[model samples]
Target: MDTTTNALRWVFLFLMHHPDIQDRMCTEIEGVVRRDMIPMLEDRSKLPFCEAVCFEVMRLGKGSPHTAPHTMKQDTEINGCVIPKGVPVVFNLNSINSDPEIFPDPSTFNPDRFLTGDGRLQGTEKMATSSMGRRSCMGESLAMMELFLFVMALVQRYKIKIEP
Candidate 1:
């Protein structure tokens, strides 16, 4: 619940800060979905820009800054440094999400980064916002769906503006 709420909040805040992006999203939504009708799952594929915005929100929000502490099961080497078994390791998701190498201009709220040249949502395997492997977020799909629906609904119906 918190994850979804935070994602929505960040999305709205970003939209308010970047009216140009918000207008682009609204234009995209209005192109496919009728003004009187709410967006549905079938419309998901048609809204690549909206999907990118949602991904950017999650990336910039860094809702879960660190994963649950994981203990080393065996001796391992990372970047030539040896890690012994039983050592606790907390993956810094914020660092990964903001890494310049992975996300160019990491601090900027640019949804286009998530979009391909053809305007499709690129796979998020490298984003690392959602923890990877066995302990990854189980609610990832649900959260994404909720974020998409909520964002589409909000942007379609109103103009988001920042207050003084």
Candidate 2:
């Protein structure tokens, strides 16, 4: 759990310092949500900008760089690489997520890529954070929901700024 905890802490600290992201996130929240109403799960679909920010954060955030381990059940080929059955596989999420082919200019933190021309999330489905097969992480839903709420609450409260 240390890996997960440290990753989350780092992400929190990074967001706290990044004024551009904080300003954009707050503006998006303020535009969609009334000040009086607390953000809820129902608000998620209506808040595409919010979702995009969260997606960008997740993409950039190295939360749990070392994902939980999994063992291969049967022989499989992925990306032209073949593995025999019963081989231990460590899915380096960091590499896959930050790969340039998958995310252009992967090292740069940009939220605009996730948005459509009209300022909505471009993807129809959430990207998978864990393995697709039988050994996928079980906490996917819980983690996503928690992260979303935490970010929304932060936006609702603080108007973030960079100290010069």
Candidate 3:
């Protein structure tokens, strides 16, 4: 179905599988935001661990590997290969998501990757979920905001786990 909805499902599944992560995210939510206050976009930065969880979910649950086709504006050399102008290009989200060079042990659902040594939110804006730059998904921010709020609210209210 929808890619954002798919990723959201993955997030809950991951949390169900990893109670430690869910607890940590809940702790972050509990410690940072007031119980009566609804989590907002501004609160996102205050909860780095939660953001990390979201980033990790986005990284692993990329529903569509290849993006919409785009044509190169000019000759572009990437790494070593050269792409001529007018050539079509489609970024593979899976490739970037699983690239060992960028994410060590890429297959693991390690939210810590988005955190720094002291446990602060790092540069997760570079995640492949929305691609990058002008060509990125127009609703990326809205999607992320929805995801952040959802995960925060859900974890705070419920103990996610396997039913069986």
Candidate 4:
């Protein structure tokens, strides 16, 4: 789908532009993941920086510009705007990802945003994107795993260099 492919493209582009971040990702992946084996869900936690890169892709990249339409079961109010029950509403993911409060200097592509002061990967509890939430895509979990593995596979196997 366009969403998944766009995520890959964005990840590559971001890494290409930010080799320091890419190097950190590779270092993290190499530290925990074996070169001969493909990464698995169990490896997700050990590879914090890799997971952070994937998270950054979903957050900073416009993987899915907007969510699918859904009708609310109960009247909902967001920022004083009311959407009565039975009304279809679509959320723009970019708006959520770019919230100044959630992400400072949102324009910059920084996977470190998902990390803590000590460089530990922050949990995903507060991470929100088009594919995450109650009404999220059915393949949310699988897609997230795929994103992490996809990036992990690449950086683990090859170095991404930007040709001037």
Candidate 5:
């Protein structure tokens, strides 16, 4: 629940801070979904910009700063460093999420970064928000659906504003 709530709060904060982005999201939502009805899961694929905004928010927000602790099953070498068996390892999601190679000017809030030239929402494997392997987040799909519905509904109903 914390993860979902935090994600929502961060997205809303980003939208409030960037009215241009917020307006773009609203426009995108209005185009795909009728204002008289709430957005449905089926509408997710049509809202590329809105999906990008959600992805951008998750990437920049550091929803899961570190993945669950992992232990080495056997001795291994990574980049010339020996990792002995039974050693615990923690993956830092922030480093990957902010990597300049994958996300240029990563500190900047740019939803277009998650979009292709043809305007499609790109995958977020590089962000590494969810744990890998058997420990991966089981609610990933649910979380995404909730994000789309909640964000779409909110943007469609009202314009977000940041009070100074």
Candidate 6:
């Protein structure tokens, strides 16, 4: 493969293998879901643990890492950095999502941090980081619902094993 293609492939694998995020995902799913009970869309809102896991996953995944870019329509300053008018800019999702200040122990995937002791999201307040806004992933809701159903069905109907 060409260098560009090879580079893309490596990046894909790196995201897939990100240990802190990936392991927490598996652990959360394995904990709340039993080997029975088919997960449904109706069940999503009730699945606090599952939702938390999804949030943390998205935070770490930083969906489409380098895909979204925007342009400055007018000269602007953000976080003390100034941008010239009409300048192109890219938002590196990973950096924002994984900021240690915004997310305590950002590198560690801890879904509980997104939740309360009663097992609800810390708040219902919407933020761009909540996957809302012009830059939001259009398919976020559909993809999340699909993933929950798919994983639940697989675990209920079959035994999955990881080989050493």
lDDT-better candidate, 2 vs 6: 2
lDDT of candidate 6? 0.56
Better of 1 and 3 by TM-score: 1
Query: Which residue runs does candidate 6 get wrong by more than 4 Å?
Result: 1-37, 123-132, 157-161
Once fitted onto the true fold, the runs of candidate 2 whose alpha carbons sit more than 4 angstroms away are 1-11, 78-81, 124-128, 162-164
Note the residue pairs that clash in candidate 2.
none
Which candidate number maximizes lDDT?
1
* Residue 33 lDDT (model 3): 81
TM-score head-to-head 3 vs 4, winner: 3
Q: What is the lDDT of residue 71 in candidate 4?
A: 83
- Clashing residue pairs in candidate 6 are none
lDDT of each: 0.88, 0.70, 0.85, 0.80, 0.85, 0.56
Instruction: Note the clash tally of each candidate.
Output: 0, 0, 0, 0, 0, 0
Model 3 per-residue lDDT tens digits across residues 28-116:
88898898876778888889999989889988887678788899999999999999999999888899888988989999999999899
lDDT of 1: 0.88
Tens-place lDDT digits, model 4, residues 1-164: 55667788888898888989888887877788778887778998787778888888888887767888888899989899998999988887788788888788888887788888977888456556664467777776777777887888888888887877
User: CA shift at 78, candidate 2, in angstroms?
Assistant: 4.2
Q: State the displacement of the C-alpha of residue 4, model 1, in Å, after optimal TM-score superposition.
A: 1.0
Tens digits of per-residue lDDT for model 2 on 82-101?
Answer: 98898887877788778787
User: What C-alpha lDDT, on a 0 to 100 scale, does residue 134 get in candidate 1?
Assistant: 82
Candidate 5 clashes: the total is 0
CA lDDT of 46 in candidate 4? 84
lDDT (10s digit) by residue, model 5, range 1-164: 67779998998788888999988988888888887899898998899899888888888988888988899999999999999999999888898888999999999999898888999877666667776667778987688778878888988888888776
lDDT of 5 at 60: 91
Better of 4 and 5 by lDDT: 5
